[model samples]
Target: MLIALSFAVGGLLHHLGILRIDHLPPLHAHFRVPTFRLLPAAVFGLAAAWMLPGALARLRFGRAIALGYGTALAWTVLLAVSGDGLAAPFTHKEEYLAVLPAVGDDPSGWLAGFTEHLPGYPTHVRGHPPLPVLVVWALQALGLPGPLWAALLVVLVGCSAAVAITLTVRRLGGEDAARRALPYLALTPASVWIATSMDAFFAGVGAWGVALLVLGRKRWSRLLSGAGAGVLLGSLPYLSYGLVPYLLIPVVVAVMVRPSRLTVAAILAGAGSVTAAFAAGGFFWPDGVLATHAQWAADPGAARPYLYFLFANIAVLALVTGPAATAGLVGPIPARVRTVVAATLVAVAALDVSGVTRGEVERIWVPFAVWVSVAGGFAGGRAGGHAGDRRWLAAQVVTGLLLQGLVASPW
Candidate 1:
C-alpha cells in the first residue's frame, strides 16, 4: 500500500508531461538519443522496485542482486520471443508517437550498441531519466531483438509499477483498497499507453518513495528511505517531467495538514539527494543544474487544464468507490469534498476537450485516483461497514471504467 501510494503520487505529479503528446524536447543538449542499450535499463529498474528491501538489507547482496537480475533475464527472454512475432499491441497511437521517436535523432547508434535490443528512433526532445536509458542497454545484452525490445521493457515496468501500487494500497487502507485500484491502474486508457513502454519504471520508483513517506518518522528508517527516494525522484525528471511533482502534491498537502518530523525529513532528504546528485553531475550529465533550469524556463505550457481536473478526478474516484468512503469517514473530511472533487473533474474534461490539454488519460488523473482509493481504504467502518463499503466500491469502479470508455481509449 505504501508502495502503491508512491506510484500514485509519482503518476499524479508527472501528469503534466503526459499531455504533451505533440512534441517533447530531448532530455537535454548533452543527452544523446538513448541507444537501444536503454532497453535493459528499463527492466532493471523494475527489478529494483520489485526485489529489493528486506532481503537485500538482511541477505547477501551478491545473491540478492543475482536473483533479481536473473529473473528479469528470464522475463526478457519470454518477451524477446513474442516480440519477434509482433506479440500484441497495448498502447495508443499518441503513445506510439512518443515511442516511435523522430527518424534521424537516434544517431547514438543505439541499435548497434546493444545486442538484444530494439531500434529506437532518434528523439529530438528530452523526457524521462537515464534509469531507463541504462536499463535499455542491459536488455540489449539479454539477447532480445531490436523492434520488440522497447515494448518489452514497457510491459515489465508496468508490472512493477502495478506491484508497487498494490502494496501501497494494501499498506495504507487494506486489501480492499488495493483491489479497487488494481483494475484502474492496469486497464485504464492512459495506464495502458504507459504500460506498453518503459514508462512504468518511473512510476514504480515514485511509488517506493511514497511508501517511505507513509512509514513516517522512525529516525534511521526515515533517513534511509528518504535518501533513497530522493535519488530516484531527482533522477526521475530526466526521464519524464510529469513524475516530479505528481506525487509531491499529496505529500506536501498531507505534511502541511499535519506536520511531522518524518514527513519533513522525507521531503528534505529525497529532494536534497536529488539536488546533490545533479550538482555532482552523476544522475544528470553535462549541463547539470543549469540545463535543468533552462528546460523549466522554456516550459511555457507549464500549467495546462490548470489544477482543476486533478482535484476532480480524485473526488470522483473517492465518492463512488465505497459507501464508507462516500460517508466521508470520521476525520475532518466532509460530504461536500466529493461534490467539489467531482466538479473539478468535469471542468478539466471540458477544458481538455475545448482545446486546453488534449488526449486525457488515466495518468493525467492518477493523483485523483490515488486519493479516491485512499479514501476508500479509510472508509471501512469498525463493526458492520463491509456491505455498504463493497457496494460503494463497486459502483465507483464500474462508473469510472464507463467514464474511461467515453474518453479516448488507450488501446
Candidate 2:
C-alpha cells in the first residue's frame, strides 16, 4: 500500500512539476506507448529476473557470476531486438574510435594510456579519461570487431559490477542480504540503461574496487584484497571526473566497516601512486576537471533547466530503482551505515539541483544510484521482512522496458 501511494505521489509530482516549467522538451518525440513490437522483450526481462533467484541459489559463486554476466548480456540483446534490431550498433562508437589512435600511437603504454594526449584527442574524447578508451583499444587489438565489441565491453562491465555487488553485500551484511540485494541490483529498471551506457563500465570497476576495500578485513586474503582495492580507489579519480564524487563510497565503507590500519594505508598509497603515474603521463587531474565543462559545451541535454529536471531525474531514479525500492527510499533503514549512505544520496541530490549535471542524470548518476538502491535492502530490515514484492519487482522491470521501447532514447 505504501509503495503504491509513493508511486502515485511521484507520478503526480512529476506531472505538476512539469506544468509549472516553461519551454520543456517534447515528451512525445522521446516517449511513446509501444505497440506490440517490443512487448515480448519487455516481458522477458521481468520474467528472467523473477525466475533467477531459484537458479542463482543452486550455483556456486563462480557459476553465479557467469550467470549474472550471461543474463545481463541476454537482457541487452533482447532489449536491442525489441527496439533497434539485434545488432544495436553502438551509437557513440565515434568516441571510442577517436581515442583509439592515442593508444595505438603511444610507445610507452602506461604513460600514453594515462594521459589524455591533448591537441590530439578530438574534443569528443577530451572530457573523458583514458581507461575506458584503452579498454576499447585493447578489445580491438585482441581482434574484436567494431561496435559489437564495444557493446560487449559494456555488458561485461555491468555484469562485473553485478557480481561485485553480490560479493560486497555477502561480505558486509551476510548471505541473506546478498541474496535479497541481487534481484534489485540485476533487474532494476536501470538495467535498460545498463544495457547501453559506458557508465556501467565505470560503475563496475569503481564498485568492485570499493568492494575490495570493504572486504579487506574479511577472512579471505586481506592483504591481496586491500592491496588491489587501494589501486582501484586511487585510479577512480582518473577514470571519469564526475566519478570523483563516488569516492565517498569507499571512504564511508572503510570507516563504517572498519578495515585494519595497514589496509587503509595501502588504499591511500595506491591512490597516491596512481596519481603520480598520471602526472608523469602529462595529464593532471585538475586539467581533466576543467575539460569537463568544455566537453559539456556540446551536450544538448545540458540545456534543460535544473529545477524541472531535478524533479524529473528523481522520478526517473525512482523508476530506475523500481516501485519496491522506490518505496524503500522512504522507509527506515539500519542505522550503522544510514547516515553515510543518506549523506551520499543527499550530496548527489544537491549536485543535481546545482545544475552541474542538469539532464540525463539518470544515466550520469549510475554509480551513486547503485548505492542509493541499497536503501531498499535496508528498508526490508525495517519492515521485518523483505521490502520488495515480486509483483512490484516485475512492475519495475516493465518501467525500464517501456522507457526503451517507448522513448527509445539512445543514451
Q: Count clashes in each candidate, considering only residues at least 3 apart in sequence or on different chains.
A: 57, 0
* Model 2 pairs in collision: none
Highest TM-score model number: 2
lDDT, candidate 1, at 267 = 63
Provide the lowest-lDDT 10-residue window in model 2: 20-29
Candidate 1 per-residue lDDT, tens place, 278-352, comes to 444434343433443344344543443345333433333332233334443452323333332343345334434
Candidate 2: residue 367 lDDT (0-100): 69
lDDT of 2 by residue, 1-411 (tens): 433453354446446664222222222125556767677777777677567666665677667657766776667567666676532535454455555655675635634544444435654366567666666677787899566778777767765676776777676666655665666666666666666667767778888887887664454477678778878767776767777777777777777778877766776787788888777766677776666665666555455555655665666566566665666665554454455457567757766666766555556777666666655554444334422435555665777676667665545
lDDT (C-alpha, whole model) for all candidates: 0.40, 0.63
TM-score for each predicted model, relative to the true structure: 0.47, 0.81
Q: Cα deviation in Å at residue 214, candidate 2?
A: 2.7
